[model samples]
Target chain A: MNDSLRVVLAMIELELRRLRNDRTEVFTRAVQPVLWLVVFGTVFSQLHAIPTSGIPYVDYITPGVMLQSVLFVAVLYGLTLVWERDTGILKKLLVAPAPRYATVIGRSMSSGVRAIIQVVIIIPVALLLGVSFIPNPAYFVAALAILFVISGGFAALSIIVASLLKTRERFMGIGQALILPLFFASNALYPIASMPRAIQIVAVFNPLTYAVDAVRGLMITGNLALLPLDVAVIALFDILMFAVASLSFRKIIE
Target chain B: MTFAIDARGLEKVYKGNVAALAGVDLDVKAGDIFALLGPNGAGKTTLMRILTTQFKPTSGEAHIFDLDVVRDGAEVRKVIGYVPQETSVWSDINGYENLLIYAKIYGLPSRSRKDVIHDMLESMGLRAPAEHLVKTYSGGMVRKLEIACAMLIRPKILFLDEPTLGLDPAARIAVWEKLVSFKEEFGTTVFFSTHYMDEANAYSDEVAIINTGRMVTSGTADELKHSLRGELIKFSLSDHRVDEHTLGRIRGLEPVKSVVVTDSTLNVTVEDAETALPCVMDALRSEGIPVERITTTKPTLEDVFLWYAGTTRAPGAASSIGRVEGKAGGTRRE
Candidate 1:
């Protein structure tokens, strides 16, 4: 294999070892999303806290919870950058002849793989709760594709932050600051139109909003409502974020 | 080129006007084990970082094996293995996996990768513990593993930044042995940075002292020690308890550059020990002070460090052996 491919795979393989060493990460990550679906979704379902268009609360929140998990999983990958840099792995890799961007892609790919696992866990649980998958096979594929793209984008973003900050505590502080505000401000928790006027303005720009809307519309409403624009915006954001991430990571290594 | 590493007028200033390197000019011959010595915050690490292609100097140039460190970093990196001061290993991974990862990066033949890893581990005395996670290894073992990883490139030159800073005496000795063996076998250029005076004196074929980001002097350990044109005389008083009167008596002797007393022994720096030793002994004898043991030896790297760092022992004042007096030992600019 080419050096870049080897480097990226090597990084992912290390993460796989860690994941195998501790299955707790997968279990722990599923906790918050599961709670949101079972406890919050069910409790709110009885009260009809927000409109779900007669669809079950679990179904409406399914896309939101998955995207939330992606955000947590993706950005958390970057926070670990602090530990790696502090311990000297980052420098060890930086001195290699392989391209610096390969490391960035490698890290993002690892996060994407972990998020894929999250999606696998959430799907069965969501279905058990009476949440329906997308009717058409093609749309289901589109939802999966959206999940990968958004996950990669957010993961790239975390690496960018980690590169800039160069401290685990600080990266986490920043990542934590981002995940919830982005989740609550977007259409993940409620429809964009239903939110306050100012929130509607912010959610329109939130990548999570596009991601959840695209996934929810595809799998729930079956209309792919705004799916193209949503995909385009998230795709554009991913490209921009990846570019910045590569540049920023390069600066750190250089 | 004769020089494996060279720098001229190299300057590095951090973002907030912090000048880590202030116009450093240095050179190291190929196949030489050159050690850079400095006290903390003397910019040894910064200079190594620049030479290793980890950072850019604000001005001037550095070349590693004929390639400019900045402009031709990709080429420089290929030929130079840099084991930075950080614990340059993944604690979560075992030693063998760490080597294989770098072996891939170094483009080692797939067939030989495992064998190469095994050989390096064995050479570093880590073969028994090679499969254990790095987190479980001792500080020295981890450092040895780091060396093994860096060696995957079979670099023309290896740059180590404080390779044995925290290692115990035995571990440090083990690391030194492997380094020497590697040099002998491969004839690779080894340029390392260290604050440990003893290690530099004991291990390096050549040593350079850096102060405030500038080269103070460069030479063999004996050469640096002899540069000051003096001998270090150490003597323990037979019966006289060390009081200010006794210390002052020794300090009052003319031609003595500095006098340091620890316990009952006195270390004096004088222009020429042969001429000065008898005079000192007679003078003390005349003063009714009995000397038990007196030995005049060549200056140590510690003395050279003190002289270059401007940390001469003050009259009648006993300073710690290694801690240079800050007020006097402030890094000499010129």
Candidate 2:
């Protein structure tokens, strides 16, 4: 493999080892999404307070919860960059013979892999909660692809923030501030139709909106008509985020 | 002769007009253990960063093995392994995983990556704790793992920034032993920046002292100490009667190189303290000066540092020699 590919894989290996060594984060992050699915999904499903396009509220929210978990996990991924820079690990990686952009791409891609662990956990919980996913395996695969793409984009966005903040404490504040707004402003918690007009405008532009739309369509509504547009938008988002992140990655040292 | 590392007029000025490095010119011969010594923020780290391809110089140029650091950064990086002052290894990962990551980055052949990493672990004495998380390892072990990772590919040059800081005496010794063996076994040129005077005095074949973003002096430790010449005859007077007349009389002595008075103590640099001591004593006694105590000692690296770098103070602190009162009071500006 080429150097960039090797670097990307090496970074993924780093995340995998950490996860394998300590599975606590995977388990801990699952708690929020599970709570959302069981408590919020059950309550909202009974009241029928939000429009679900004639589907069970829990099923409509299942894909949204999956995206939420992925978004939450991936958006904070840049914190690791700040932590690494602080600890001097980032300098070690940067000083290597590998391409600089490869480091950014590699670390951001690993965040997607990490967020996948959340999806793996949430699917069974949603299944045990009687939230019916479309039986087609192809749709599930496509949904995972969309989730991974969006997760990579969000992680790259986090890396950009990391380069600017340059401190874990500041990155933490900004990351927490960012994750909630990105989640709430998107259609992850409720339909954009039920959201206010301002939020509707924001949800239209939010990358997470298109991700949730694609995931919700594939896993719940069984709709592929809008899949092409959703994929295009998130792909563009990923490319844009990666470009900005690659440029900002080295600035953490400065 | 072609140097392992060569630079001419390197300058790094950070934002807001902060000049971290100001026209630093350095050359380290291949296979030499060179130590860059300076007080805090003396541009030692900045120069290392530029040479290691971590930062670009604001002006001037540097080359590692003839590859320009900026133009051929990837090529430069391939031939140099850098261990920065910070804890460079991932604390959450095991030692083996840490080395494996570096091995991959260095593009070691996949088939031999494991063996190379295992051998490095054995050499660094980290094999026993290779499976444990780096956080579980002692400070010295983590530092050793970092060095092992850097040596995985055995690059032509290894750059370290404070290779051992905050490490205990034994740990510091352990780190240096590994570095020395690496240098001997691979013939890799080792360039490191450190604040430990003894480490620089004992380990480095050549030492360069920098002060306030400028190179003060560079030579072998013995050469630097010898550059001070002769010996220092320090005597304190009970009466504290040392004035210009007394200083002028000592300066008039044929063997005395320079005279400096600090508080009640007078430090006289002489060509030969043994021959100059009695003359100095007769001069003092004839002048009705009562001596408190007298001692003679050879010039050390610390004296050389003080002679060149002035007092080790915060950057931009007053550079004046207010404590020492004599003609040779302040540090010499090279």
Candidate 3:
């Protein structure tokens, strides 16, 4: 492997080793999205609030909740940078031979892996909720690819924010401030068409909207037409976020 | 070849207008243990950070083996290792894994990486707990492991901000021993910062005392102590307050070389303590400054720091020193 690739993988290895010891984080974080699925899907399915067009309401919300899981895991991964800074781990990595950009990408890549794990956990929950999985293998593969991009984009965004804040209290404070705004601004809980005109306009720009649209289009309804646009936007988001994150990451060492 | 570390007019001022390093010109020779000794917030860390390439100086220049730290930091870092003042480690990871990540960063070949890590663990005397999490290790063990991480690349120069901070006396000695052995084995030029006068005196080949971002004095420990000639007489005040009136009385005593006060403890440098003690006691008794006890001891690094830190302060540092209570401000002591 090349130097940067090996460096990124070494960083990923660090994350994997840490995760190996954190079994509770796996079981609990995975369970969180499922519980949200169970409560909202079960309670809202029969209420007729969502017009699912004869598709089960449980099916309509499952993909949205899975995307939520992706966003939750990816965005919160920034906290580790703050913790690393506090514990002097970031200082160690700063002087390392690898480029700072590699360090940022390595952390975001691990977040992508964690998102994949959550997708697996959410699958069993979808079954319990009477939701149908994607029937076509090609489209399912496409959905997973989209999921990875979504995870990568959000993870990169987390790093950008982490580099700016540089402290847990501030990073988490901003994270908390932005999390609900980003979630509610999107069509995670409802369709953008059903949301008000202003909200719909805002949702047009939220990455979570594209993430949910892509994942839900392929997984819930097998509608792959918008999948291409969704993937394009998320891929663009990942590239843009990674570039901006790399720029900001240099400031950390400064 | 240039000096192992050479810095000229090195200055760093933080964003808040705080000057962490004012103007420091330093030279550390190859294969020597050099200590930057100073009180807390006296720019020791700032100077170390600049030299280690962790931060850029606001002004002036520094070079490690003649590579400009700011412009060629990547090249400099390749040949240098830094152990920061704080615990610069991943505590949740085991000692072996910690070394592995560092080995990879240093681009150690996969074939020799594990062997190098094992050798380092063994050399640091941490092989027994190599697999155990660093969080479970004692303060000394953690420090030693960090030093091993720094040494992973066989750096020609090792920069330690405070290698034995927060360690017990025994643990401090352990870290010192590991450093000593590592130096002997690798001929690495070790540069560490500390407020502990004894740590510098005992371990380093040369010492530099920084006060308020300025290099006040730099020399061998023996030369520094011997700079201030005469015996040191320590007077323990029966009452914990030495009013200015009493201070003047003691300062007026004939044969008193100099008087330095730290709280109620009075250190009087004189040609002879025994001869001066009785005369000083007579003066103090008249002034109602009762003497609890008195003793004479050889001059030490503490006296050396007190001499330099007290004498070399700029106008601004004088007030800061007063708030620091007329002594070295750091909590760590020799």
- Candidate 3 wrong stretches, greater than 4 Å: A135-142, A250-254, B230-296, B310-334
| Superposed model 2: Cα runs more than 4 Å off | A195-197, B234-268, B272-294, B312-333
Query: In candidate 3, what are the lDDT values of residues B174-207, reduced to their tens digit?
Result: 8998888778988989999987878999999999
Tens-digit per-residue lDDT, A1-254, candidate 3: 37677777787677777776666787788877888788877899879897776788888878788888888888888656766665667777777767767777777877877787788888987897778887888877777777776787788888888878776668767776767778888877888888889999999999889888888888878776777788778878887988898888766655
Each model's TM-score for chain A is: 0.90, 0.96, 0.92
Interface RMSD of each: 2.0, 1.0, 1.6
Evaluate model 3: give its TM-score.
0.83
Cα misplacement distance, residue B36 of candidate 1 (Å): 0.9
Question: Would you give me the overall lDDT of model 1?
Answer: 0.80
Model 3 superposed RMSD (Cα): 7.0
- Against the true structure, what is model 1's DockQ? 0.45
Candidate 2 lDDT: 0.85
Alpha-carbon shift of residue B269 in model 2 (angstroms): 2.8
| Model 1: residues with Cα > 4 Å off, grouped in runs | A49-54, A134-145, A163-172, A217-231, A250-254, B106-109, B233-293, B310-334
Quote the lDDT for B44 in model 2: 87
Which residue pairs does candidate 2 place in steric collision? none
User: What's the CA error at residue A14 for candidate 2, in Å?
Assistant: 0.9
